[model samples]
Target: MGMKVRGISYYDYMLLLFVGGVIVLSFPANLLRVWGVPFFRGPYYDVIFVIFVVLALCNLWMSKDSPLPSYYFAATLLLFSTMVFAIGVIRGNENVIAGMKYFALPLIVYMLLVGRRFVLSFYSSNFLWSLVVGSHVFCLLFYYAFLYGRVYPGIGVPSISFAALFFLAKQKYFLLSVSLLVVLLEGKRSLLLALLITMVFMRMVRLSVVGRLIYTILGIGILVLSMYLGLSFLAGITGSAIVNRINLLNPFSGSFDILLGSSGRAGELLSYFRGKDTLELLIGSGSGFTYEWQLGYASTQEGEIKGYFHMTPANYLAAGGLLGLVPFVWMMLLPFRAGALKESNDTRTVAFGLGVFCVVQSFFGFNLATDAVSIIFIIGPMMLLSEQRRPGGATALRSNSLERTS
Candidate 1:
């Protein structure tokens, strides 16, 4: 028999440790820069990437199972990466390595997860709950100790959002509230939107077919109205920065123009395709391609910078063109595969909700491809899918369920 620790197999325990390390190290390095902490930068991510790739290869070597749908998802990402790299070569882009790594990171993680024959149940594991709570505690201490309670985007928002979804599915209302509060403090609008969408998905999945159709029709109008009233209330009490962001939704104030102007997405898109030939448009300028955009006063002395677009659609289209965009969309939709959705079990539903959260967040600026925090979103659901395919997997999952606390 395999060695076990506290009833978990040695390999499963190692997986948990790997996930915990990723969570700790995945905080935005830019935030640390403000405090003069330079340790958590590019090389740290490279180390994690190397570790994950090695684990994936080992798992693949040990497993003898047939290919699953998640494997196809990984393959698609690989294909997208290959296409981007080839186009980069043709264009002789010198920054291809930098661009290709973004796409490759997700591919390797997905492969690592899909290769696993067994995975711990995220819903019932006490270890996961403790890990999440511990991370949040550490975040709070760090904020108070180092940053003097200053709030900025990317203070573990992705990991906290994932924790929130897990807690919500488990009906751990208190922990969910804490997670949401942390996310709000981090000040990421995308994470808030994702949480709302995932909550709706969780509720919808439990209803009957007809009930879901009716709920969908009614829910849209209610959701919009509630959001308007809620945001309006929040604007009154929140900081000016958040209030300014909320004001971008006001159509009466020409919010669309303000948004487009502020984000520079429209200008970026126009600049990207203005002079491209048909063939170039079809396959893109490759991964390392960059465009010049005006910068805010705080950014640089030159008043402009050259970089990739922040918007996912714009970035992917520029890097891989139409050929790359299709697969990116497919990879995002992998969580909704029929087999994963057919069962409404708590574990499956929670995994599904996290998947939805990531997909929704991807549109705004969440780089599912490059962000290390995205590992949970891919791993959780894909592991469930793998379990579903294994014989007696459902029973095994049921047995793994145990009471957990904050």
Candidate 2:
């Protein structure tokens, strides 16, 4: 247990570096621009990304055994991604390589978190608490920026995952309340909805009738208060009457419209292959081909906007076609499998909830653009694999063969 860095026993140093990378990546890029901090710009983020990738590769090579099924599945997915990238390269899709860098770099971090021993040395309650605190700091910073009418690009998925982990730890619900408020203010309706579902599920499974009753009452009160406060802030910004702003917050106001629109989009995505040749339909337009197929944001740097399919399955199908879609789908599901195999009941609950949340979110959000979110979605549940063995730990096979011989 004498984990050392230089002369100091700094086993947690890897954890510190990982958190630092998250913090650096989550820094308000807009502020850097306003301050003319060229040194803290894009390449700074890339440097940290490169460092983690190198570290992950090193750890992977040195790892004696894979800790989790998600690790193996994720590695397989990464290989499939590489094959897709190779397809793009062969076809001379010149920018495919550049576009994939953003998608691939975060994945390296995901791999490191799951597969690296140093990072996973003590992924217990204390580790979860550290993540929760870091997430709260992240949430607070993002909210303050929003209050000032400055929208900085950052991910709330980590905050949401941390909140889920907090519940799994059976802590007082104070942090959950704060997390909900921050997410509401951030206006990520999908994640907010997922949080609501997760809370309901957690309450049903973990709380008694009386506890659930109290939770329900408190949750309703919090929901109403959050809506009121959120609308008031928006009213202040838009100079709209308070009453009118409240109307805009109506839960049912656009439900039907959204459902219809989403359905229509899903239909369109599914039918996109109608006129394509069999080869194109099976192999896709090519990896990163969505760049030519979709729209880009005006403010995003030229060539930086990864195309969006608005649906996860569609995105994969369009990018990798059938060839790339299978492993991607399996990768998404492996979290649930990993969770189911966990010994802890709470781990199973959280892993399944987070897995469902991520799957649902993918229906509405773009994957490549939300790299931070995707990382949490993949690795959050994957943490459950820390205690698992590789399918009877090398002796089961011998035992089975012996039985067969008999």
Candidate 3:
């Protein structure tokens, strides 16, 4: 592991150390099940969850030679959050705690992974690509089965076969088609839309002509398959009535027409914040409001069954508040910018899309600590492979420098 980057060779055991920590955390998160920690938890089966966290850490630590962004943004965000929590404490407001979940994701990821080489590591590129596609396939299939009433106790359908098809079936039109099916079938339009937009954007603005053509053909096939399956899934779940209530997914649903319903919650906050010229839009939302808002926030008043799962970007605003989220958001775009500024290939393109996907996924149904690491996060970052030649000046794999983190 000894390699000189910017004249530093301390990377010798960083990867091992990181992997070891992950292995320890991973076991508790997976094996101990109900006993490990609070905010994060999962069944004994979620090895992927713990593995990714480790990967993210290792990716950063290993990439020690690369200078990451100044931590000002992340630091400020944490500061704002801490101050808000402090205020909430004095007033005994609980809503500030509600911000915990929303605030945790990027903070933890950035605090651990940012400014690290693993993110751009060539060794992790391939792993990340596999991670994104594989996790989506699993979530997509499981969700499809659930909607169709086909989900039993275990993996439904031929997961292995589906996985093969998933990787091999990459096509623009096909991806779009399949994405639409997944949206309707799983009733998770956010993820479906994220994939669709990503694939289309990649094809039009990012990929080569040959890649686009291949992706298009596959896209068509996936569309047809999705249509067939999605219809059946809907039929098994809610029947034609799903069509009637589909409009409710808009967030400004029928239920939000009245006072403080999810729709009007914003109006409430805006009204509350109105006439406040002295407020810091760039820094924080004051305390005591967390309890008043969350236990009582409009995301709930809107009649949402799961108030915390609001699809609005407003959640980002309200939960972590402004100051806390700014740098986190910026840090998120760091990789995409790096890819664009630096010459990259399909792997970097794919990573860009997945990073966007994870961002979008957060706005919807995901939890703070599902007790597992999300597959998208893992494979998305792990997929980069080595691009440099071997040491001793040889060009063979592993014989030379091996991979480089993108």
Candidate 4:
């Protein structure tokens, strides 16, 4: 039997610690920086990640489970990273280390989780719910008590879209409501859109094939109508910063420039591809690629800022071109493969929902492969998927042993 502590398995606590550490370190690290904490530095976060990885490796080493999925994922990431590194070397990129860190960290986290055997039971779900909700509560308190009504996007919490979907899939309405409220108060357009889409999706997926078709048609019409009417209504509202920001998106203005100009992403995308030659366009400029783009929307400073694109497509295109983009897209769509969505179990459903949310939100600025904390949310579900694929649904012996000890 696995070791137990206070009626809970040591392995379960380790997983909890891993998840909690990411939640604390990712967005809340910003809070630490504001408070002048030295531990907010990159090395500290790296240390936590390293510890978790080492622990996971040890567990995998002791287990009798097949490691084929882990090997395949690691190989794929190695190939991609190698290509990016080679291109960076050839192009003499100075920020290759930073670029590779951003590109490889999430993939490594995913690989580690997918390679392991873990059970997502009631205890796991409750632990995740409490941890995520507790973090949001603390962030909300800090936002109101310290920031004095100023909205700092992602200030104290990483993207909660995956958690929100998981809660919704499990019919944990209270947790789902709390997650939605947190996202709504955060006032991130992309995140709000992603959560809303997830809510709609969970509802639609429960319907029959014909019902889903009808729902989609009706949803599109209602969504369009709502956008048209809501934008106009919201534009006239006063004293709300989020509404004021929403007012800027005037889709009826008959000009793409007006709509896309607000985010400056259009300008960034254009500048990214403007001068690329055929070969450079095919394979990209590699990691650490930077381009000059006007950042008029920025609050702190405005002008030409040289850095990576905020959009995932632009980032992937600039880093790995079609080779990177195709695989990235395929990875995002993996949760939708045959038998994935057919799982009747709530835990598996949560995983399926998270995969869908990740795909939808990728278009809006979330990058699972780049954000370490955000990627942690997908790990459990993906591992569950891997387990389900095995003949006779191989049980997670570690988790079972731990349960027995408990």
Q: What's the best-to-worst order under TM-score?
A: 1, 4, 2, 3
Relative to the unseen true structure, what is the C-alpha lDDT of residue 180 in candidate 2, on a scale of 0 to 100? 63
Candidate 2, residues 1-406, lDDT tens digits: the string is 1222222123225544565445434424434543356866567657655666676676566554654445566666677678668777777775786657644644665655553322222222333444555555574575565533453322344344445444544554666566566655544455665566555444333455677588878877887787666645544453433223233444433322322324234434534544577887677755566443221222242334234466667767776778767755665664454333333455455545555555656666664334543555455445434424454422321221101011
Question: Per-residue lDDT tens digits of candidate 1, residues 79-109?
Answer: 8888888888888887888877666766666
Query: Model 3: per-residue lDDT, tens digit, 1-406?
Result: 2222232123423532443234234322322233234443533334544454565567566657754444464566567557656654664655655545344444445535443333333222233224333454555554444434432211211112122222322433454344344344444334444454444443322545676577767776776576556544443333343342333333323422323323334444554345534444433443434312323244445332232323323444443456545644554454343243222454455445545444544444332223122322332242222122113211222222213244
Candidates in order have lDDT scores of 0.63, 0.50, 0.40, 0.60
The local lDDT score (0 to 100) that residue 85 gets in candidate 1 is: 87
Q: Give the winner by lDDT.
A: 1
Determine which window of 10 residues in candidate 4 has minimal summed lDDT: 397-406
- TM-score for candidate 4, residues paired by index: 0.80
Q: What is the lDDT of candidate 1?
A: 0.63
Q: Compare candidates 1 and 4 on lDDT and give the better one.
A: 1
Model 2: pairs clashing at backbone N, Cα or C within 3 Å: none
| Model 3 weakest lDDT span, ten residues long | 153-162
**lDDT (Cα) of model 3:** 0.40
TM-score of each: 0.82, 0.62, 0.50, 0.80
TM-score of 3: 0.50
RMSD of 3: 9.8
All candidates in order of lDDT, best leading: 1, 4, 2, 3
- The sequence of per-residue lDDT tens digits that candidate 4 reaches over residues 1-406 is 2333343356655665566556544546655654557776466767766775676566656553656554565567677778887898789888887788667765566555654444344223555555667676686677668774443444424345556776777678898788888777766677777667656665654556788799888887887787778766665676776665555565543222432434766667766677679898889888787776643455443457555776766677788877877556656656543224324556455655665666666676636645654454444455556665676443443233222132
lDDT of 3 at 185: 48
